[model samples]
Target: MFGYRGLTISDDGILEISGVRCDYLVEKYGTPLYVFNEEEILNRIKEIKENHIVKYGGVAAYASKAFLTKYMCRLIKREGLWLDVVSGGELYTAKSVDFPMENIIFHGNNKTYEELEMAVDFGVGRVVIDNFDEIDILEDILLKKKRSIDVQIRITPGIDGHTHDFIKTGQVDSKFGFPMHDESALHAVKRILNSPALKLKGIHAHIGSQLHQNNIYKLEVEVLAKFISSIKNLFDYEIEEINCGGGFGIYYTEGDKRLSISYFTDVIHKAVEECFSRYNLRKPTVFIEPGRWIVGEAGITLYRVGSIKDIRGIRKYVSVDGGMTDNIRTALYSAKYTAVPANKLNNKDEEQVTICGKCCESGDILIKDIKLPKLERGDIIAVLSTGAYNFSMASNYNRIPRPAVVMVNRGQDVLIVKRETYEDIIKNDL
Candidate 1:
């Protein structure tokens, strides 16, 4: 089973991911914690490559924005996955770990002049061009260096990804990419073809994130293929590279067919190959940047039950020490997640209850109606399918310090990210 959703509690009343126990982790690391299974993340990379890329010749670019630490960057490199970094900090994280610079792709809609220069100066594998303004910046630097920067055009293919509205990037009305139908985008592509500072390697489009349907992805490929056909004469594009953005979904619970990356990739390969063959286009090196599917289920947020309050006849509230501060996907995107009692997993499930965070807002409910086991103070609850966005989006609201992160592997554990201290908190205070 994919390690993302396969967690079980031992007979000793200890919850474990794969073979790594959670009860001992909570005892040693304290509640309000994060635990990631190293094996799961690595397996996902292999699955993505074997199932999708081997057939399609696609490059699996691990989106480093999800939960980046030097250890994570190192892991991504060890697994032979390319990196997709959006900022100087993310690039720095990958660089410090000595991730292959030739395998790194820099992306951002509004990369600063300094950032753009640094990316080119670092000789990143590619810079995903998002807008006309970015072209100006790249030209300024690449011209000064008199070296063409390999790049991909981020285009909006007008296909809906059907995920949360906030995270959707493929829509024409979005700010992330250049509109595919626009003359401006075509002009930018033309300029890239004519320029000495920039090389137009391929076209890129991301339909959405946390996607559920594979058909939507097929539709996106069709659109991109048709457009590529249209521009073949003007730009003479031979389809050397084509990046279908990553938004492949994974199951948060039962019946959520976040189809396997392997399965999805094969289907994508067929789609792209068929389209390219039909249109007489040369085969291109396929590329996909997946952040969530690679790491989401591999992570779990461990929280300690602080109090259980029964609002007489209204509802019961199981409060945890950390809430929106650590996992804001529930509050910010109404993202659904599943939780199980770390020490009480086998107990009969009861009626629904709102799992509330210790945050100040009433909207900080982690799960609106989770039928979890009967709980008590000091109980540890592990929130699953949180590896992607939780820690990367953690906030310091109400001035509470963030939780620590630990990675478990082969029954051995190590503290990957240290807990933030109070003094560390005020260190930035002027």
Candidate 2:
């Protein structure tokens, strides 16, 4: 079980995360507040190590797409973990925090010319290349710069992860990576092997995210091992790394079940060790990118309940000050989330209400038919497990301002990301 340290749930049902009460955060930062637990984030990193670090010497990188800030980068970096950056903007953020270039692994299926050029110039440690086009792009850039770039070719591996189809990248039909059955993929491997300007270092594959089973990853490793082995035999070449890609799921709702980090580690370890021993394969350094599990449960989004209307013939609507503009998962993925009355902490459960966002779209529903204590205008509601995709995916829809993000550690709470103002929206406009 993932336990939240420095937090307590009072008998009155009030939730205090990292010594800072959710109610207090609402009062201080206003509605649509994002509260993060500093300790819990680190704890997740430790969980990965506890569960799997010993096997083939595993290393973990916090997937920045899950939610990123300079301080968040520093926190993860300080804990001695690597980072996975997907774009130039994310890479720029990592650089802003002075993240070590050697520890950053650049990942993207369609990296732009400028992004690739910038990464190479910046000297990023590893580039996780997705397609043959990208292979050509990187080689072109390296030839021009007269520099050799360390690269990892991403293979489809045909592993359809048990998650939303849109987010799964390992399936053959997906937009990411080279498909295994396609002869073009073998040609891609040979191309990388022959390219003197690009050093082909490894194979990368992401099974998917929000995954619930460890066996899925076990199968991924098994398949990846065979893929790498075949490449070695065919090309007489060897790479030194195997990036498993991160999609480890965190507990969202009470009914959600996730494997312990140790269990996840053991499964991968057994798979890798067995394969290498059986094939007499050379062991390569293992890398994983876990995003949500690190920060999802550590975050709580606090929103102030606005007006409440009971439509007798229809469903009751309790509008919040912010909505899909700030956290679009509900509207986008039909993603389910849990919420509680932050201000009415000690109150008993008394109402079933549909929590809607202030976004103009009716699809801006946050939680549908959520049970809560008797609600009042101005009361604050805290939504749990939003640390992953909320801020990273927030948009200016309805022209609403983005919410602030804060880190709560020990008894101190500090703002890490400030809420956007109306001026921020029109800054780029004429």
Candidate 3:
């Protein structure tokens, strides 16, 4: 009902996703299942390709931090989009799939020496240098290996994004990149220019996540363009690429203002053209790394209602088998979401109820004060727009094994990840 493709209500009032009944999925995959619509994901990617990549000759990299799997790696590769990995584990996953290491852009704030070695050894396409210490570590590794790698310096654009404070990365006081008003960035550039192993290709900056305004990105471009011009004047070197990291917002609840892919891309492309032209600099190759936009709306979490508690004149609590461990955004970022009764889609009896998880923490509520069909024990509840961070950020808190992940498309379903077992939880215990 929130406008995800392939979602419909059956004649019998059952909620169907991609031509498959939600109850059938619960029967097969069990409670607390992570279901993704494969066609919806591809459509999002296709939209990026058409609006940003093809229209402006830019690169679209899938930010793997939002969600990553061996299957996801293969899917990204097959779609002709680049992969953005921030840790050695992500790199290993990509390597396991042979996901074209040259198409990979390695990113991390504090990349360990071993991870840098792995990136260098595996011949990753680009390493986004976050700090001066990382530059030194990577230079040392490259010197020891006698190999050169293309690199980009991540700069703090000093622009605060219109998002939560926890997710803001491009602010001046952030720990992510070199600050614009300081000499550290310039010093790092000088060091990289002298180092034979590190090739400084360009600059990158990601303001924040869940960004809604397009003008904010335009301002980021203007700031980076001015910096690039100053760099050319000082070092006489031209930057070949400008990586404008992605935070395009998606529809989660009715209150969220969702913009089209073109809404942001059009502004970004125009800003790059105008600003770079004004600075008299050559137009550089642009790269955008989108994680949530491509996957958020395509995913839904199915939880079977377990318990119902009603307090007279106060509130009603509908507990599910899953909670913060399965989806932590509600507790972490105070994120909002929408849901529906999969089995009672057409039910007329509705009541205001609070949806909560099975975790022991009282703050582990998923949705608060939402109106839904009068719920009962064993009812199937499907929460929408959980496709991005739910599976990737899931944990085994309270020894609760994580749920399986299923991808549905064109009336077909396949389990992409297996549900964790009790033994799997403590398999590393001595």
For each predicted model, how many residue pairs clash, with residues at least 3 apart or on different chains?
A: 0, 2, 0
Rank the models by lDDT, top first.
3, 1, 2
Query: CA lDDT of each candidate?
Result: 0.85, 0.84, 0.93
- Residue 92 in candidate 1 has what lDDT? 83
lDDT of 2 by residue, 1-430 (tens): 1243345766666678887777777778887888899878877787777765654478788899999999988987888888999999999999998899988999987899999999999999899878887888899999989999888888888888888867788888988888888676788888988898888888888888888888988888888888888887988886678888888877787778745676676787788888866776888888888888888888888888889999997778999888898888888778888887776667876878999988778798999997888888988888888899999999898788888989998778999999899999999998
List residue ranges in candidate 1 displaced over 4 A.
1-6
Residue 301 CA error for candidate 1 (Å)?
A: 0.8
In candidate 1, what are the lDDT values of residues 1-430, reduced to their tens digit?
Answer: 3234557668877788868888888889887999998878877888887876675567889988888999999888888889999999899888888888999999898899999888887889999999988998899898889877789998888887788899898888989878976676788788788887888888888898988788887888888787778778666766578898888898787658767886667767788889988888877788989999989988999998988889888899999999999999988898998888888867886767789999889998998778877898988888888899898989889888988999887788899989988887889999
**lDDT (Cα, 0-100) at 355 in candidate 2:** 95
RMSD of every candidate to native, in Å, equals 1.7, 1.8, 0.8
lDDT of 3 by residue, 1-430 (tens): 6666668899988888878899999999898999998898898999999998898999999999998989899999999999999999999999999999999999989999999999999999999999888988999999998999999999999999989898888889998989988788888888898999999998999999999988999999999899999889999999999999999999998888767899999998899999999999999999999999989988899999999999989999999999999999999999999999999888988999999999989999999999998999999999999999999999999999999999999789999999999999999999
TM-score versus the correct structure, for each prediction? 0.96, 0.96, 0.99
- TM-score leader: 3
Find the candidate with the highest lDDT and give its number.
3
Clashing pairs in 3: none
